[model samples]
Target: MQKKALIAMSGGVDSSVAAYLMAQKGYDCAGATLKLYDNPQCSQPGERACCTPSDTEVARNVAARLGMLYYVFPMQEEFRKNVIDKFASTYLNGGTPNPCIDCNRFLKFDALVKKAQELGIDYVVSGHYARVQKDPDTGRYLLKKGLDSTKDQSYVLYSMTQEQLAHILFPLGEYTKAEIRQIAQEQGFINADKPDSQDICFIPDGDYASFIEEYTGNSSAPGEFLDTDGRVLGKHKGHIHYTIGQRRGLGISAPQSLYVCGKSLQTNQVILGKKEDLMSSSCLVNDINLIPWDHLDGPVQCKVKTRYRQPEQPATIEQIEKDLLKVTFHEPQRAVTPGQAAVFYDGDTVLGGGTIVTEAQLK
Candidate 1:
């Protein structure tokens, strides 16, 4: 019997090539693009969106060209509830949110799994640059980095579970971006030269606060900027307009340059201090998800990354309390912001990760 697979197509070169590769391998395949959002507000008069109408048409055409079945999954409500709303709320709470993680957790992996099950699909395939390998000893599926170092996407995928990893396939794991583009060209894909989406799909301009205000129908109220000593520095535009480690756009004059170190929800104030004030030795993380094992019996030293593009730093992971993990970096890390993911990596394998909660209690 042929193995049935569903390819999550985004109409880009990577996904188009992924779909082609699966079909060529003789897997029974179908293509589907999730209609996540329209972004009627954030987009300008003429702009290409990540998953807009044009992209959908291209995906549909590609599926037809490949002689496979295709459909559009209208998932606006799920994307808004799970991703956009959380992004706005996290900012309001003084923590910077990573919406891409939420998108993968809710829309791509979880929601797609349910959809595939309903259609009697045996496996879910995507273009994410990651690999799934089974540990011969424990027989557990492990998430490993892609062969391409520059295009590894294992950080945002840290929320995947054992079951999810079991039924997922990444055809681009062993290929570089250039190779993927070449494959697309060889297959005569229309989007062979299509550029990758850079900004957030919905917020085309990257003006986060403006989109938050428009989407939520609430304005960010003006707030006070306070120094680390609790003295007034200046009046800030709003708390939502600032994030930890931000140095520019302060609109303040001081003897020395200042940076945003923290925010106080209680007083609605933004904390400003010298660059040194943002450095921290440790941080607490919640919502833990580990891949290789069920739980950590003891401290494991590995490389940890607080942001997606940042290089991993050496750190020690300890499970201090239920649902909480402590990461103590060998050197002081600057701007260990809350609401970001702290993904732990053991060489090319992902050990686990959690949402960074705070650096306050770690002190």
Candidate 2:
């Protein structure tokens, strides 16, 4: 019997090419598009929203062209509970959340993997630009950066477990974005030339505060902006409207530029300070997930990426407690925000990552 695979098609050129590659490899393939959200308020007119009707239609068309069975899994409720709710509550609690990580953790890897198992599928495939390989020495799976360095997505995928890595496939790991697009064009995929979705799929306009307010039906109360010394600077619209390291739209005039340094949920204050004040040398990470090893026995020197777009910095990671890691940077890192992931890497291999909880000044 032929091995079976389920392709999680997002109606993009990358995923379409992924499905095509899997099918060409002689795996009995099926396509699935996750219907994650449906509210018109969450999407803008004339904008491409993942899992929308048009996206699903394109995915279905691609599946038909590939002669593969296709299905739409309605995951709106799960997405709301896992991604949207977590995003809103994290902001409400004065933390910056990465919903894409949550989506991959809870939806694609966890939920969809279960769905594939139920259908007797041997593997689940997607279009992520990351690679997985088994280390022959340790017989452990390793997640590494894609061949195209600029398009690597291993940062957001650090949460994948060894089991998931064993069964997941990334067909685009070795292919560049341009190659994927060309393949899609050759295959006549409808979304071959479609621009990649930029903003959060649900919040296309990028008004996070407004969307959270409308979704939760509760507006954030106005708060005071404070300096590092707890001195009042000015009033802010709300704490939710700002993030650490933000400098613009502060609605305040000062002799020097001020950046958001922190937020106090208890006091409902947004803290602003000079750029130098944003630097932190160490941070405590929780909800830790280790990829290359079962446990981090001692301090390990590696590069750490605090945000998706930020460059990796030299850091030493030490396991201080169960489910806790202390990442001390060689130099002060700016805007070490809580609720964002601190993904550790050893060269191109992902060592592991976790949620950043708190930071401390350099000694």
lDDT of 2: 0.91
How many clashing residue pairs are found in candidate 2? 0
What is every candidate's alpha-carbon RMSD to the true fold? 1.9, 2.2
The 10 consecutive residues of candidate 1 with the worst lDDT sum are: 40-49
Q: Candidate 1's residue-wise lDDT over 1-363, tens digit each?
A: 999999999878888899999999999999999988866753342244477677888899999999999989999999999999999999988889998899989998999988999999999999999999999999999999999999999999999999899889999999999999998888899999988866677787789999899888999988899999999988998899999999999999999999999998878899999999999899999999999988889999999999898889999999988789999999999899899999999999999899998745344
Best by lDDT: 2
The sequence of per-residue lDDT tens digits that candidate 2 reaches over residues 37-80 is: 87986645336556567777888999999999998998999999
Off by over 4 Å in 2: 43-48, 359-363
Q: Could you estimate the TM-score for every candidate?
A: 0.96, 0.97
